[model samples]
Target: MPVREDKRGQERVWETRGSLPEPMLPLPFTVRKTRKETHDTYTLELQSESRPGGLAFAAGQFNMLYAFGVGEVPVSISGDPAAPEVLVHTVRAVGPVTRAISGVKPGDMLGVRGPFGTRWPLEDALGSDVVVVAGGIGLAPLRPALYQLFRRRRDYKRVALLYGARSPRDILYRRELGRWDKRPGVDVHVTVDHATEGWGGNEGVVTALIPKVEFDPAATVVMVCGPEIMMRFTVIEFQKRGVPSEKIYISMERNMQCGIGFCGHCQLGPYFVCKDGPVFRFGTIETFFGRREM
Candidate 1:
């Protein structure tokens, strides 16, 4: 069986080719490869221990990664969902836990627990015009969704990507972004908040690029991620253009204490960002979304 069927006869779709013990436990995975993505950021590719083959995860879900002796942090899974042979995560080291994770070298062993949280609603987005808005590291979580769309191009109408970063040096997946921008039927517009020598991209926030892209706001499904403030403003822009709140989705980055909803650290009003979301339909959480300090 490609997946394990429980006593009740429900199929476990997330089982890797060979499968592992359980999804909730921190399964050991050896870092197989690493790539430097900017000065302070890197991406790690891991192979599961003893047949932890390709881990199945929806786009926008995260894994709680434990760097032996350092700490654990919730990081988005940033790989193609169709390929199930490797696990990937792109991280920007800003805190102690993340710093330790970025310091890991190939062949090092780490523990991972997840494929948690909701997805980007790629299924619902099919047959509709698609607008993807990302800021800085926010692009990491959206990478998989883009991969799926391109691989199955006939499933959607027009597609556009609007990305903004703090600076040219801060752009994540620069090489891939270039390639994607060149892909037929995909429109990519990237901007920067600030620039230095040799930089020639748009000099503004992400929302500015929104108005510049051509899409039927009434027919588009929007997916946005970044700092909470950026998402708030991006949503407002889409709303002004006639996109309904129900069609706008945003990924929430919170201080996740536990991958499960047991911990209250990621609480957002009545919902737990870790379990109930991390990705939420803007309409569902619209009232409390822009509230101060939430």
Candidate 2:
């Protein structure tokens, strides 16, 4: 097993041939709790006695969760990295496998395989300004990164989060966003496509809120997660603001059949999204990022 330290000097278990005998094998994890995040989204808290200390995962990594006989899907770890005792995943019941996983009872067991892919570069962004942009359900994957930044607020300068949803009701973590906005030195802005009754927030694309927050583009690191088109425009917006493409990271999702890149279902140009990244620097994939033909 290869053990390495991230920029924070925290030991992390990088999955390797020595870490496990079978990379495809799934371990049993008892579903501890489930919470309805929205009309179609559910957050599951899973526990496994097989590993008492819990799953050590960085912010932007995902797990190949197996729902018994149904099959598997890659879900990002949405919980705080500091509290790894209970693994948490926010799942949207959009497909058959996800529906099965999200419908599981508290005592049901789900097979868990990995904490794979690249992570948000929080350590490298230390002492710089940080901006997070999320759209719709895309907030799930970015949640863990926000937890770490808030936990160590003094390490960075200005911090901001700009999020968008279809409507106010579609907001994922409403309460937490309120709390985050109250924190000193942090700015949180939210918008929706449609303005429903009783909704008083900004009503537009997330990019419109970008100008509302203040940050030094030269020293800012921006992390984005959203629909492909949304991310494309986000990168363009940030670039126009003078944020370099190398400082902008985006999380992507594809047809990831094999979590370890054996199947090549998630190939993006020359990079295998499963092995190389789910989080990639915007400049690296600019050519094929928003192309449907890719």
Best by lDDT: 2
| Candidate 1 C-alpha lDDT tens digits along 57-80 | 878788889888787889999999
- Badly placed stretches (over 4 Å) of model 2 are 1-21
Stretches off by above 4 angstroms in model 1 are 1-24
Worst 10 residues of 2 by lDDT: 10-19
Clashes of 1: 2
Model 2 lDDT, full chain set: 0.87
**CA lDDT of every candidate:** 0.85, 0.87
Per-residue CA lDDT of model 2 for 202-286, tens digit only, reads 9999999998999999999999999988998999999999999889999989888777879989999887887677888787788
TM-score of 1: 0.92
* TM-score for each model: 0.92, 0.94
The residue-level lDDT of candidate 2 at 214 comes to: 96
Q: Whole-model lDDT for model 1 versus the true structure?
A: 0.85
